[model samples]
Target: MSRKLSWGAAVALVAVTASVTVSLTYVYAMKSFNTKVADINERQAMYTKLSEIDQKTRQDYIGSVNEKELNDGICAGYAAGLGNSQAKYLSAEKYKAYLNGSSEKSIGVGIKTVQDKDGNMEVIEVTPGSPAEKSGIKKGDTIVSMDDKEIVRLTYGDALNKLDGAAGSKVKFGILRRQNAAGPSAEAKAALLSITVTRAEYAEQTLTSSMINGNVAYLKISAFTDSNAEQFNNMLAARIKQGASGIVIDLRSNSGGSIRGMAEMLDTLLPAGNTVSYRDKAGKTTVQYTSGPNTVNLPISVMINRNTFGVAEIFAADIKDYKKGLLVGERTAGLGTKDEVKPLSDGSAIILPVADYLTLNGDVFSGKGIGVDIEKELTSEQQALLVRNQLKGDQDPQLQAAVSALIRQGASVEKAPGTENAPVNSNAAATE
Candidate 1:
């Protein structure tokens, strides 16, 4: 079978193999070249249109133009055109500050807005004990101006950046507020209000525990960070070791955080089974996390409010669905999803949503919050006081209701001691 070929035949075979290899290489090279050319052409079209606009503006512009603003606007417009509501283009400076992401107790005025509707910053929330809250800034208030600069006239990111500064610094805000002391209502017309607030550090990821009523333990989860989740397990075990029979988990005003962190905390509490899951666009179901076999045997009670959002809702939902605890307070905020930030070469960036969210039982609670077993409501003032570390003991009705629920679930109660119950907020604490 081992036979040597003739020189002429061998030469012909070599030629055939070399020709095929060269043909494949040529085809691949052409495909790559064509793809690059198409990309360059697309970019050329965009640049051409932009140059035309710039040329016209230079030739017949009316007033002085801020080149920095114009450039930032163009980049921001491109991101906005992507059609993702959560998409926001951060300028170079903003991107830098964002990367500087701090865990400081305080950085800016404690006003949170998720929307820039109608060119005005809509005030969706104000942190308790924050300079904004102390200055009478409440939720539903519209930020019309920052330090006398109209918000509509300035870039939104720039305005947001202005909100951050050193502690003890002052910033002035022009607020357009509803006449009603509560949230927004159609009956009240918007009134212009102005106030100055001093910014200070606030405890951002507050997680602490104490013996509640001698037998029941109390844990306040402000934000679900990995550190906090780990701390939670240790604290819970310590509380249990101290002869605590049950626990009251307060999650009010927690806008939520890392899903992994939430799952970790749940793992310490839930029995072996599926914890939470999510579905992608391709209609495939993926289990996000599952609980271990060991769970602390105790009556659990979770405190929730309307401001409880994202992962916090999932925490509350798991507790409710499993019937492991009774949910006390108002309905949740009902907002959760996965978001990703992509930075561009020019130092600009975009924040966009990448996936949807679902609760433990595979239910979509987005836009609609989970329900509570025991409904205990509070006024805005009371809600603020209850968390500023000012609200405690008999002063907080919701806390009382939660403790009472635990008592009904076979938890032993004793005389309320001089225990400190301070709130940990999901958002960074700031005075604005």
Candidate 2:
């Protein structure tokens, strides 16, 4: 009787297990089918769009459009649209390397810093288990000197570049820590921290956006990575849906990403068609970024500074030339070199310039930055006020200027306190 009961229990358990396996198999199969369907739909849509673009090509032009030119146009247009006009067309290997996002090497003392008030280089964040962190480097500590150069004037990019060297190399640093408001106390001695960090590839997240003042949309792009164009398009659509009026594009410290990505962004904003032109290696001039319908009618104010560089320069120049919106703040950092990311056999990458970049009207912006129409230089007192607002963690000055300018141009600034109407005082707003 006991043997019979045990056999029955085993049979029941086996049946239950079989049922679960069948159910799970069905669920996974359905999920895979749905994913395949979605991929097909996306590919279909892409094919249709490309077909449309190609359908319009005149036979003469089509015959002459070599593989290189087509690829170059696509790259240039995408870069121009996204505001990084300095992007050079990348070959397959180079594009692969660009997509990898891996820095060729990493140095010890993994940390990052930004400028603070009183012109000090303050450590913003320290990587855990990094040489710097292990050697008593803390967040909020001031980095006085690295090797020899003062950190006060080095841009964040320049500072990082200085910190990077061949693996197994040691770099000296002098640091200061501000314990309290009494002023920064220097470290008792220059901490000669040493570490041999093996060079490893790392991925950096490149796209981020937010709504400012509950309505104004602000987009911050660090570099033109592979997914930047697609991400920006989706974000812009979202911002428009959220009732974004004025856009303050903060490209202040953007070191430029991809030219093709820039063009893609421009296509979303401006009417599509040949927005930027470039000369390829074959001494042939090509135009890309045929305009699309201008979608958002909102006033755009692009914020740039001495740190805004690379393809960002092309954006400021082209947009200003087209009289699309206002370029605000200071002159941009003129880094107009379009580099091809050449991946070597050893898995290292070299960014080489293939061709010169040009504006739609044939203006060259490489090494020459775009100047803003409204130059709002901050006085020392104004700089202090800005810094205070910044320390309080406000990225609002450029937005304020953008909104104010738009308001002056007959747009409603904002609803006055205890008033039903969004009050409009054009002259006062302009002066402000």
Candidate 3:
């Protein structure tokens, strides 16, 4: 009877041990599964949330939605999520326009407009011999309406589209011109003018060069397009043949363009050394050096403003880093990242920031822009006066400052044969 009882107790203990082991195994498996599920949910949060919103909108929205626009918005939102202000997604139409507009020729009214503090479109420049110029649309003119539609409510891109159409198409513009705004309140008045302009194909000249003070060669590069390097080299050669004592490069309001073009431009001036470098996401560095024979050895002064950005900033940084030139005017726009246009599966495309750029001294200008050697800040009143003076072929203070600095560096007024010694005019130089 005692042996039987002992055997029974051992059996009972074995059964309990087996039950506990099974329970532990089940709990371990469930914990692992839960962890994996949590991870998947975290990884797919963006996709899941987007899907939810899309579903709700399709089912509950009152208005009929355009799927194309919705898709474009999604693409743009995805790019905006990258947290870079310069990054953007372009729709099919916008992308096509961007590609065509970058070419040597384009059809448009030939006016460059910028948004003011109140989001109104203000004409900053009218191309020479273009329809906008022929229509008497001057710089500093605020565009009140385009084609009878209020332009204040439209985006800059939309306004640009309105200004750009097929050749022979006519567009009407209502402009607000401020009279004598340079003087005190007693002389200021607003006048409205309506004019019609016909669109036509114009050869886009990105760089304009002229002799300032009959000795200093002034070059205003509105943008660094594909042909800019060739144009720049030609301009430089022309100026050299004419015996220019100094050179002033006006990069103000130059939103910047091709990196290759900028590099080529720098190659002309930079000595045989490191000009600039770029870093990738994998911590790899690619260094670019100046390939000499450096031809441009004259005193160079670069003028910049708050509107100077992108590759233009790179140009300024390198000049400042190598002590090759004097940087005048306000600080740059501080955008130094290089972007690449990536095409999506759809017709849309995105401008993605692929790399970060550094100056010759290995300094990055991301949020902090490059500083100038001679900093000059123009007040609103001074800026208004500058625009007025520039339109009248008068001297611009920034250009004057650049010329003065070059003159101080032993740049004398050595006029080329048959060239008159005249005060430098920024408008005439830009138009040339």
Candidate 4:
């Protein structure tokens, strides 16, 4: 009876141990399966998002954009060990300096460059007063190389960089010239010339005024530079106090700068409570209102041409709209949009158009350009004649016309070359 009880107890013990072992093994297997299933689901979700991005890019909606294009734009950059092996990429600041434009003063070699049909660079213009012009560098001269450097594959940027250095530097350029293609079968001839140029400091200002013939004030503005607004304010004050009756504001060759400068000047000219509204992206509108008293309420005539752009156009349009001044001579350069410069990771930058400008009447002042109140062009004889018969004077015919228009409006005049304090009536006398 004792042996039977011991055997039964051993059997029960084995059965309980096997059941617990089986339950633990089943639980471990179920947990492993769940972990793998979760990993697959997460990967699938990531791939789905990528697909959506791709699809949206292909659709040409304003809301949709190409991820690749945006990434490769000026905002993004190259990965490690990428780009041209032989070339050095510029930094962001360096690229910005290139776009900002620099004043280069070289002892006037006067070589004008143009791109050829085969993409070869050539000289198109040369000023007679310049050193290169004196050195027999003329039009139709093809530039082959410079300073022992081959320019066969060099880009326009690279070539320009090579041309720059400290003042008094000498650079030799290899050129080829073709006389004629229609009559002669002569091949282009090669010419090697060395031009030594001493660079000078060039100062550009937005506002410049000088009193001619005692009373008439002539103000020539090139651009709305940062320092120019203050200068303009002080100059205007002085001119107004000087008891001037007529003003000639020359905007010819003046590519406009800051819009703020335009508004500041407009404030001095326009009455209070009136506003100048400009348009931006998405048809959004921005307005700048006149907030101060008017300055120099005298007879005025503005000089304009194909080079008068941006804020210059806006100013001209404002003057016409308010009937403040006579818009004399030619049309304006129709670049009426605002742009923002975006820097890239690899140092390249892009200028993106951001806004469109408008008049006080909500008119778009672009594409068609600002129209002139008086239509005038230089005659063949007037165009042939150099300004004041001097080396440096106005080449723009519109400038001569502006002076004429001012005198026509019964403003005092200073005739160039013959007599002092002479009142001229005819256009010939005005031009002379």
| Per-model TM-score versus the true fold | 0.63, 0.55, 0.77, 0.54
Better of 3 and 4 by TM-score: 3
Q: Roughly what TM-score does model 3 have, to 2 decimal places?
A: 0.77
Best by TM-score: 3
Give candidate 1's TM-score.
Answer: 0.63
What does candidate 1's lDDT look like per residue over 254-338, in tens digits?
8687788889988888888777776677767778788999887898989999989888998889888877889999999877666
Q: Which stretches of candidate 4 lie over 4 Å from their true place?
A: 1-94, 98-202, 238-243, 273-276, 288-291, 345-347, 379-397, 407-432
Q: Evaluate all candidate structures by whole-model CA lDDT and list the values in order.
A: 0.77, 0.61, 0.79, 0.62
lDDT of 2 by residue, 319-430 (tens): 7777777888888876665466656453434455676677767766666778887776555554443332231113334445655655554444343212222211111111
- Residues 1-432, candidate 3, lDDT per residue (tens digit)? 999999999999999999999999989989999999999998699789989998998899999999888888888888898899979999988888777776767788988777776667888777778888887899889998888887767666788778776678899888899987664557778999998999987866578788767677878887887667888888877887888888889888787887778888998988777766888788788985464666577999999988898989998888888778899999988898878888777677899888889877777787888789898777676565443334221335666678778877778865422243333333456332
Q: Which ten residues in a row have the lowest lDDT in candidate 1?
A: 423-432
Candidate 2 has what TM-score? Answer: 0.55
Note each model's CA RMSD in angstroms.
9.5, 24.1, 9.6, 18.5
Model 4, residue 35: C-alpha shift (Å): 41
Better by lDDT, candidate 3 or 1 = 3
Model 2 clashing-pair count:
33
lDDT over C-alpha atoms for residue 375 of model 1: 98
Q: After superposition, how far is residue 97 of candidate 1 from its true place, in Å?
A: 2.7
Per-candidate clash tally: 4, 33, 0, 0
